[model samples]
Structures are given as C-alpha cells and as structure tokens.
Target chain A: MSSPSGVLATGSAGDTRPAPVVSIRGVSKRFATTGDDVVALTDVDLAVAPGEFVCLIGPSGCGKSTLLNLVGGLLPPTAGRVEIGGRPVTGPPSEVGMMFQKPVLLEWRTVRENVLLPVEARNGRKGAKAARGRADELLGRVGLGEFEERYPNELSGGMQQRAAICRMLIGDPDVLLLDEPFGALDELTRERLNLELAKIVSGTDKAALLVTHNIIEGVFLSDRVVVMSARPGRIVDVVDVPLPRPRCLEVVTTPEFTALVARVRELLELGHDDDGKDGDR
Target chain B: MTAPADQRHEVPAPAAPPPDTRVAWGERPSIWVRIPTWISLSGFILVLFALWYLLSSLELVSPFILPDPMDVVAELGNMANAIGTGGLLAEALGITVLESILAFAAAVVLGLGFGFLVAESDFGRIVLMPLLVAVNAAPKIVFAPIFIAALGFGISSKVALGAFIAFFPLLVDTAAGLASVDRDKATLFRSLRISRRKTFFKLQLPSALPFIFAGLKTASVLAVIGVVVGEFIGGGGGLGQQTKIAGDLLATDRVYAYGIVLAVFGYLFYAVVAYAERKIVFWQTPHGVQAGG
Candidate 1:
C-alpha cells in the first residue's frame, strides 16, 4: 500500500497518472539451503513509475538484490507475480536491463563491442552493427569516446563501468535494474558517476531501480529510497527525498539532504536492533 | 566524507589516468637493463664453453668420455650433411619430429573435447574426473612399455604414448579454465537473455583460452618426451633409437650430435606453442603480470 510521496496512485480532480514500467505484487523468494530454506525477500510489493528513480537501501543480507532480480526476471518469485510493461515476467524481460556491482565487461572485447553485447544478444550481429553509432554516443556521453577501441582490462574501473552503463542502454530497455552499480568505485568517482547517471536518466521515460547500501548515494539520486530490514528482508521504510532536481555534490551539505541521510541511518540501525532482538527468541 | 566543492571535481578527474592499452608483450627492460643482461648471459656461456674446450683438448678427460669442442663441431657438420643427404640420423630426426607433431595434435583434440565435457556436464565430471586424476598421478613415461607391447615397434605406439602423456595437462587446465568464468559475467549473460551457445562461445571460451594455452605449453614438452621414451623402450626409428645405437657402438660424438639435435627440436617445439599462446590469448600479459590501470 506504500507509494512514493508526490507520486499519487489515484488522480485527484482530472489528472491522469501513468502506469508503472515495473510492477511487483506480493513477490517472495526463498532459497533452499542444506539446513533450512533462507527467506531472501517476503511479500515484496513495489512499483517504479516511468522517469522516476527508486533506490533499495539496507544493511547487508537484506536481499535488496533479490528484489532487483525479481523485477529483472532473473529469479522467479516463489509467491505472486512480477510484471514489466504490463506483461507477466516469466524470463529475463527484454524491457529490463540489469547491472551488477562489477562492470562485467568482456575482457577480450573492445569497449564499443562490449556496449553492443545486449543488442547482439537480442537481435544478432547485424543488430549490434546497426547500434554501433548509439554505443559510441553512449560511451562518449560518459567521457569514454577515446577508449571505445580499448579492451575492458585496459580501462580504469570507473571507465569500465561507464562502458557497462552504455551497454545497458544500448538495448533500449524500458527499465534499468542496477544492483550496486557504483558500489565498487571510490567516493569521488562514485559521486561523479552519480551526476552523469542523473543526467542520463532525467529526460528519459526509463524507470531505474538501484540497490545500494550507501545512504548518501540513495538520497542523492533517488526520488524515493526503499529501506529493507535484515534476512527475511522486508520493506521497513520508504524515505521520500524532496530535494531539488539536478542535484550536485554540494547538496550533501544542505540541511535537508543531511536530515534525510540521518533518518535512513536511524532506520537501518533500528532494523539491525530488531534483527538482534528477534534472534533471542 | 565531504570534500571542498572544488576538490571534489579535481579528485574524480585525476583519480584514474588513462590505462595503458598496449599489449603487455612484456615490460621491455630498458636498454640499460638489456645491455647488462645480454652481457651477463653471453659471458657466462663463453666461460663455460672455454672450460669445456680446455678440459677436452688438454686431455683432462679421456676422448671416449669428452670430445673436443672442435670435434663436436665437426660432428655437427657431418650430421648436417647427413640431414641434407637423407641419411640414417636425418631419417631418425624426421621420425621424431613427425611423432611429436602427431601426438601433440591428437592430445589437443581429445583433451579439449573431454575437458569441455567434464566441465559442462555433471555425469562427465563424476565419471571421468577421478579416472583422469588417477592416470595423471602415475608417471606417464612408465606406460611406454605397455603401449609398446600392445601397439608394437611402430610410430603409432610412440604417438599413443605421447598423446597419453600430453593429454592430462591440457584436459586439467581446460576444465579449470572453463569453470573459472567470472560469476558476475554468468549473471550478466543471463540478465541479457543470451543463449547458452552464445554464452559458451562469447564469454566462457575466450576466458578459458589462457588456461587452456598454459596446459598446452606443458603438454607440448611432455609430447616430445613421451615419443622419445616410447622410442627408447621399443627401438623404433627416432633420435631416441639413434642415440641408443651410437652409445652401444661407443660413437660418443654421434651420441652428442643426436643429443644436440633432440634438444634443439624440443626447444623449438616449446617456442612454437609459446608464440601461438601469445598470439591467440593476446589480452593476457606475458608472465601473467596483470596490466594495471
């Protein structure tokens, strides 16, 4: 029943609300282990509206990644359903592009070729060749124009991830599923990429659901930050960021941004305490 | 951590310099380092050669035991003439080269086939893995007599022995390589809805090439050894048989001549594989040094 603030479910007066690009309803995932079945996520319901950015943030083991996977259609829900572009997701949906913490660029491939992977995967070699101009444009947008012919191993970590982002966009997917895509970068590089990412997503109709543990990053980028609790991962809070759009690195110093960060940290600690108390039973 | 606004932009820009994109053929030592290295190498060899010539010419050792360097050179000239004219030593050398090449080819085909099978399927792994381990644990040269007994004194026996010896390293390395595909890459492939065939060819196979080549390099050396050992046991035509005959006849110089030819062949075979590895797995740095950002 929880929806991001300002994103109204029912149109008041005569306003028409757009349908979400990604919809997950009562989705639960349990992983079978030797001792017992591990509940990764339980009764997870989420909707990412087109042109909105949502971040899932929690301490480790909260299964933020599991929720992303559900939307990505990489993992099937044990209960309920997930829909992308109004279609029930039974496999990796062509409408979604997923990225992990690691760039996952093919070392043998040139950066341009790596960016064209998804298109090639979907539409074959001819499709990839047709998309080369777009791939180079994406790379150039991320300051990697000169490095397109270089291999993944030849690029720096941030540059490689930039190439990976171009790869995700080359498929022209409706939704982006990012699982800690910038979690591996240094603080400065992470901030710069965050700015680039915001610019990349702002004018587009694509919805982004990013999973991150960093509180500042979530607040800086997302319209709403979905906080989950540990282990039997449940949505504990959905902190709305009312910060001004096109935020820069200076926004972190503002009282509102700092307040939002402190609130999320408090909720995370509360979740940790709750987990500790539950273990005593 | 909050940095001053101006410093924030500065750090991101300078944090990563453009990575060295050139193939790490190797870190080419500076001319300063190269000159000294060459000097030391040639100096050591010259000293050894001078000692060898002095020890022989002064009769410090009997001629039967150690021939003069000049005599060895003369013997080399004779062997070269024999090779040019298609003499016995030349035929033996040709047979040895043919056996090594054939064994290496057979080992590569079967090793790659079985390596992939074991790596890709549970049934193949469960049944063949233990058998491979057991066979690999044994000294492969010892099996030459068994191959000779079954296949007789022929080129086939030598090739069989060579392939049997060389096959293990390639198979083990290949399986390890296939299994070592990055977990994230697998997930990325799955997320992209890439076909299983494309995933194998595009992602897994290229990643496994380095390991497969490493195994091949080891197999190359083993292939030659296997063929020679088989020839030694079976008295088939090869440098191994020629050397044995020369030793029995007290033709010490001829034995030395055959030894030199065999050593050259082995080195060349190994060099050829190493060169191929460098070409095929072009991304990998020589000596496994990861080229840095």
Candidate 2:
C-alpha cells in the first residue's frame, strides 16, 4: 500500500505519533462509469495529526481531490478504510468540515442563513439561536460581519468564497477538508484568502488537508506539503516548511520559503516524469 | 480563434470591475429603451380601439352582429345593475373564482407533496415520472364531462376539473426543482451528517422554490381555464355559462360585457399572482413573466 511520503511519515527521536485527527488506511477509490472502471486513487494511506496543516499538491487528474472527498466521507473507498478520530467513516462524519471549489452557498439564503445551514441541518430549528451567534463570530473573523443579510449573488466571488470558508468553520469541526476552495478567485483575492485561511485554521485547533495545484499556495499555507503522482495517484514526496509561524505574504519572497517552493516544484516534476514514462510505454 | 475587433486579450478577472458591483441599486434604465416599450404598448391599444370604432361606425358588420365600442363601454354601467351578489352573472363570477382558487390550492399541495416524494428516491422517480408524463400529454379539459358526471354538476366538478388541469405542470416543476440540487451543495449536507428531514426542508425545498413558483403560476392560470371548461360542458354556472346564455339570446352587448369582465378578472388574478411572486421571490431580479404564483 502507498503511504504518506517516507520523509514526513518518519519521526525523529521518541516519535510516538500523536493521535491524528484524520486517518486513512490504504484508501483507494474506483468509479464504475459506463464501461471500464476508473481508478482514482490506489492504496493511498495518509493521516492529519491534530492541529496540523497539510496540503496535497498534484497535477490535474492526480486524484488529490478524489482523496479529499474520500476523507470527507462523501465517497466510500472501494478497497480500504477512512477513519476520523478513531472511528471508521461509513458515511460523512460529524467531526469534519468541508469546503469545495465553488462557494456552494444556497442562492436563496442570506449569507448568515447559508452559514447556519449545517447547524440547522443537524439540530433543527432549535439549533438556530446559538448557531446564529457562532455564524456571526465566524463571519466577522472573515471580514463579512456587515454582509450577513446579503444574498450570495450580491457578494463578489472573493466575498462569497470567504463566506463559504465561514460556513465550513461554523460547525466547529475538528478537521477541515478543503478542495481547492480558492481555485476560482483572482491572484490577489487568492493571496488574501490564503492568509485568512491560515489565520483561521491556526486559531482553532482544527487539522486541515487542502488540495491545490498552485505550488506557491501549497508551500505558503501548509506546514507540510504532500506531492502526489498522476493517474492512480500515490504520494511521491513530502516537504516540510521550515519557515517561521504566523507566515505573512512577505514570507513568499524570503530564501527559506523560496527553497521550500523550489523543492516542491522539483518533486512535482519528478512525479510527472514517471507519468510520462508510463504513458510512453 | 482571432480576438473580436473591439476586445482585448484573454481574462478571468477582467481589468474592469464586474458590472454587478459597478451598477448601483437604483440606477435608471436608458430613456430610449424604457420609453419605447411603454409607448408601443399604449399606441397598440389606442390603434386597436380606433380600428374597432371605425369598423363598427362604418357599418362593415351589422350593428346587431357587432355592437359599437361606445355601446360596449356603456353596457358595463348597465350590466352592474343586472349583476348584484344574488344576480345570475354575479353568482357565476363567484362560482368561477371560488372553484379556481380551490383547485389552485389543491394542485399546489398535491404537486408539492408528490414532487418531494418522487424526487427523494430513485424508485419513486422511475415509477411515477412516466405515468405523470402520460397523463399530462392528453388534453386535461377532455375530462370535464367525466368530472361533471362523477362529481356532479356542482362547484365540486369545476374544482375537480381545475385541479386536474393544473396537476401536470405543478408536479413536473416541483420534482425538477427538488432534484436540481447541486452535487457540491448536497455534499455539504452529507458532510454535516444532518438529518434527512432537515435536508429536505432547508436544502431541497428552498432549492425547489423558483421552479415550484413557476409551476404555481402555470397552474393558477390553468385553474381558471379548467373551471371555465367545466362550466361550458358540465351545465354549471360560471362566466362560461353566462357567455353561452348571452350568445344564444343574441344579447351581443351583454356578451361584450361578460367578455370584458372575464378579461379584467383574468388580469386581476394574474396580477395578484405576480404581486405574490414579487414578495416571495424578491431575491431574483424580476424579468420575463411566469404563468402564476
């Protein structure tokens, strides 16, 4: 079975792996379409330790998002198991939060209502009063305190994505699985959101596993970046960022950040180099 | 492909800000675009009235066959005395309005309930969709006589016919709306591990609102038709019966009066639905008309 890349998986002296918030045990996914089965991920084993921030970086069709979906329990692993906080995830786990490529806010709902959707879904109308307060706190943190009553269409793409980030946080889940949440935003908005996400994730003890194609993005926000190979994806490398905590945008320009970003780029190339060979054969 | 003549290079976040943000809430439409539509509608109505007056005054058709527009207008005043709460025409109006509203209510409830059922499960959708389509294909009004026979020639028959006519579109739109939930949105619900009932109310029902309202609009208008048809064939009392009676007696002016009343009534019914739509669907920027609420 393919596991998290060897370097990061290995521990230094007295390495007793702290209980991970998320745990995947040889998880693989296969989509049975009209004809041949499409293997999305193969024997993929990984874990997110409590309060850790991990990023999965891969080329298109590398099954990184597929893996995220599996961990979120939206899709069952055909061959292996996914567990969150020591429980096998037969279905979506209440302990997890999810953010998607699009904001996925209910269009008819106001921003506050959209944020409170999961709360309402879990607790019924009784959950309303307390959840409203939590929604307000999260929205304010994301700079959307004043836009609570506005509908999604009224907000900009950046603003809508920010609200979505808040929605994911409102559940106060221990783990966050974000599938390229800022993929559609512009560069400037993306940078701003990346900072906001970093701050939000760090302030809470929630472990985060995000999938991104952007090299700099994966390196900047992640404590450790997992690089996976394409088509039947397997993690080939993991690079730990040595940059100091409370990373600012200016950190992107420094030597240590540049070295980590360069290392990730090199690892990605090596992963794809194997893909090119397999394709030729 | 070559770039368009007036355009710049490729973009996602275009250099210019989005129009959604740029345009202010109360910005007025250009005068040329706004005034022309109102002018054209008013002019068309005026021209139509003038043509009607000329054709009647010039004696193109016999006065007995076609009354003057002036006479039709005057008849509205005279018809008021003939139409009290107890009068035949007034009773007919009451019957029609009551039957349609009742049918509209019934269709909305039945359609929404059934639609949620069909949409929630694959088995329900597969079993019920074709049956609905088959029933919807045939002319709904053809059952007016059957309804009149089974339910009797009372307001019950008219309501049955109205509900029958309205059932198809309401069922279809409601099911579609509920089924149209985006996959990503559904994932959010799943990830939260929320109860199925809450998902239906908070996600599926709200998601289906626009489509359900569309069906309501169509059904509301069709309800009127259903009731009128019931009156026409089933020997009931409504504007349809009044229209038929006037035709037989050669009360051509009185026929004109009933026609105008029906037209005005139809518009008022439609306007009420539109107003409700405006209130409920306030989130959407209003454009092109739907059938009813």
Candidate 3:
C-alpha cells in the first residue's frame, strides 16, 4: 500500500541503460493458511544492472525478504515473472549467489570445505578439489586464511559470517543475493563488515541486491535504496545514492550522506503510517 | 558533594567480614578442599564392605542368608582359579559373552533399518510407531518363557530375548537423531539445490551419529541383562544358571560371586561402546568447551 512517488529505476529505463542482470516485473506472492491466504507482496518491480548494488529496506514482514527469495529462486512469484540473464528462474540459478542472515555453516566441516559447498553441489568432489586455490584466495581476502583448517564451531559470529561471504563469492556468480547477512552482529562488527563488503563489490561486474533493516547500512553499501511498504508490500521509493565510489566509513560524517539517510528514513515512515491506517484490512 | 576532596579520598573502615566457605564459580578447588571422584567412589564402597563384615561378624543375620565378606572373597578367588584352569566358571563366562555379542549385533542392524524407515516416511511412522510403542511397553522378561518354549533351551532363545530388549533404545534414539536436523541448515542445503540422496549421506547421517552412539551404549548393557534373565527363567547354560544352582544348594557365597562377575562383564560391555563413540564422534566439543558464539 505504498504511495507511489518518483519513477521506478528499471535499469532498462533509459536508451543508454544496460540490460539488467536480475529483473522482476509485477511480482506478487501469497501464502495459503488454514484460515486465509496471506498476501505477502503485490505488484513489485525491480531490476539490478551489472555493477549496481541495490538494497531493499522496510519494517518487519514487509516482504523485502519475499522479493529476495523470488529472485534467488527459493520461492516462485504468485503473479509476475522473475528472470536472471533474460531467462525465467524456475529453480536456483547457477549464476546467482545467496547469503542468508545466519552464516549456516555446516558444523562438521572445516572453514575451507564450507566455502566450497556450492562448488561441490554443482560439480561434485573433483570440482571442489580444483577450486581449493580460489577458496584459499577468497578466505585470505577476508582474513581467514590462517583458520581454514578449523571447524565452523570454533569461529566467532563475525568470523563465521566472513566465511559465509567467502562462500558466496566462491561460485563466481554474476549476481549476489544477500538477506540481512550481518543483521545479527554487534554494532561495531556490523560497521566493519559493511566496509569490507563495500570494498569487495566495488571493482566487480557483479550486480548485488541486499535486504536489510538498518537505514545506515542500506545507504552505506548500496548504489540505490529500494524502500518498501508493510504487508502487501510495494516499492514506495528508490533513492539513488550519488556518493563517490571507493567510499570509506568516514563518508558517514559528510552532510550529503546524512541527507540521503534522512531521505530514506522519511519514505520508510510514510510507508509505516499507511500500514497503521490499513490495520490488517 | 559537601565533603572535602581529601576527606573523600580516605575510605571508611568496614565491619568484620563473614567467612565465605562457598566455592567460586569456575575456580578449581585445592586438593584438600575437594575429593577426586574416584577416591570418593572407592571410599564409599569400602565403607559398605566394612558394614557388611561387621553385621556378619556380630551374627545380626544368619549365615545361610548373609555370608561373611571374607567367604565371598574366597569364593571369587576359587572361581578365578577355575577360570584360569578352563573349568566350569570359564565355560559359563564364554557362553554368556558369546550370546551377548550375537544379540548386540542383531539389535544394532534391526534398530538402524527400522529407525531410518520411521524417520524418512510418513507411512512408516503412522503404521510402525504404535506397534513399536506397544512392544516397548511390555516387560521383555515376560517373553523369556515363550522364547524358551518356541526356540528350545539353547543359545537362540537367549539371543532372541536379548535383541528384543536391546533394539528399542537404539531405534528410538536413532529416529530422534535423524528427525532433529537444524532448520536453518536444511534451508542452506535447499538453497544450493543439493540432491536428497546427498543431503541424507552428507548432512543427516553425520549429524545423527552421536545419538546413535548414545543408544548403542545403553543397548549394550541391556543386551547382557536380557540374556542373563532368559537363562534364569529357562535354566539354560550361562552364569545365570550357575547362580540358580548355587542358590538351590544354599551356597549364598557362590551366588554373590557370580553376581559380581556379571556386574563387571555388563560394565565392560557399556565401556567398550562408550570408547568407540569417543573415537568416532571426535568433533563433539568436550563437556565444558563453549561451541559457537
């Protein structure tokens, strides 16, 4: 029930615009329960161009996660179509990498083995063996090179999430789907991880879509912030962040950064008020 | 705020403190303050032995009912000598050990097969669970006479009874372990689109191993007890028959000696399974180690 505002950023809008790597058009989802069918989303449209980082943010149960799941092929949209690389997504696409809120590392496997899970699933044991060098490089980039031999239970929460990020990268996927990957960490750890994530995705051709609850986080790491409304979710605003690339944590101190954060916050409040007035009708 | 800075710097004298005999959290106590487990256990055992000896010496209980501790010890020595010479005691111990091992093997195979069925399919759970519960509810000893009558007064009947008693624990624990996989981990597998076969082999089986081992430990002890009870009811070969014969002759000391030997053998069976669990499930954190953040 979001009030429509500015024109949506379709990534296919302008004549010079590149074709989007991930495209969702007029997607809706509903869940059938014993009493009623819960409408999770309604007529949501979004696209991520190559090298663009987009974040979806809203209050709880706003279906930001539902939209992410649709793109990842974990759930099918009830109405419109979701496509990756111009093909309809019927199942988990090989070119898309996903990271969830929990690290969800297999407890019995070592750090290196956990990172290679997707590789093994796709290509079996030999493929995982051939990719060990790439796994090591990714782990080293995240400061986990020395701990590759240790099991998941031995690592701290922050370290486990870093390992999960390494896992997402190991597949060499063209698009990344992240669902609040750092939502459980402490404030300081979350900030540090945000910086790390930004650095990792900067020079890459990969298109990234992140779902988060933190306003500062959505603004800090994304090129566009997709503001969503409460249940029966729809996009209310898509704020383009004009901050320069290769950004650092110090950018938050700038007046320009403060204004963008304020803008997203305002749209979120507007959506929240619309939800209260509806009152589950 | 009214007090001068110099006066505030001076601390007030406190009253005499009460003694703190309570132990501090996570602090290791001095050897003098806490007795080791083995020492306390053995000390309590020795006290019980002393009490038995005093009661017997004072003639508080008749000799026919309560033999002296020295007499029981002498009987144990005699049995040990007989075992070394490959006599009656040795034959009985060998037979009992063989029956227990065979029964344990049968129990494990049947338990794992049925456990997997119950855990994997709705039809199996709905049809088999009530039957399993009813079988487990009945006292297994009640079936010994029937087994003896059907299978004859031989090793087969004892093993049948033992396996029937031992398999329930293994089946129940295995089903529980397989069904208890973490929800988030299952989602992770689905996200990767892992095949169902690979998921069972790579994820569910490994996670269920610790529970299987726990069941094995309990079942090992039960197997031995079941075999002995079968022998007791049917007067078949084994230490149980030996104890019955000694009791009929009013040889209380011999009965006590056989009971002690059976207790030791049962403990050995349990200990072996526990040792195997530790070796196979080495990834399990030690008792006090914190696992994840």
- Candidate 2 segments whose C-alpha is farther than 4 A from its true place: A1-17, A273-281, B1-44, B61-66, B84-86, B121-123, B286-293
What TM-score should be assigned to candidate 1? 0.88
Q: Please write out the lDDT profile of model 1 over residues B1-293, one tens digit for every residue.
A: 54333321311233455555443656665666657778888888899889989999889998778877777778889889999999987898999999999999999998999999999999779998998899889987778888988999989999999999999889989999999999889989998888899999999999899999999999899999888888888888888898888888988887787788888999999999999988888888732322323
Better of 1 and 2 by lDDT: 1
True contacts kept of each: 0.44, 0.39, 0.33
Across B1-293, the per-residue lDDT of candidate 3 in tens digits comes to 12221211111135456455455454667774588888988888999999999999999999888899899999999999999999988999888999999889989987888889889989769999889989899997988889999999889999898998999999988998899788768877887899999999888988899999988998899899889888888767788889888989999999999999999999999999999988877678642233333
In candidate 3 chain B, where is summed lDDT lowest over 10 consecutive residues?
B1-10
TM-score of chain B of 1: 0.83
lDDT (0-100) at residue A204 of candidate 2?
67
> Could you report the Cα RMSD, in angstroms, for every candidate shown?
5.5, 7.3, 8.1
Per-residue lDDT tens digits of candidate 3, residues A72-154? Answer: 89888899988888788998888888898899898778899999999999999999999999999998887777778888777
Q: Quality of candidate 3's docking, in CAPRI categories? A: incorrect
Model 1, A121-223: lDDT tens digits are 9899999999889998888777787777878776678887888899988888889998899889997778877887888888899899999878998999998
Chain A TM-score relative to the true structure, per candidate: 0.91, 0.91, 0.93
For model 3, the TM-score of its B chain against the native B chain is: 0.85
Q: Itemize residue pairs with steric clashes in candidate 3.
A: none
Alpha carbon lDDT of residue A23, candidate 1? 76
**Which candidate wins on lDDT?**
3
Q: How many pairs collide in each candidate, listed in order?
A: 0, 1, 0
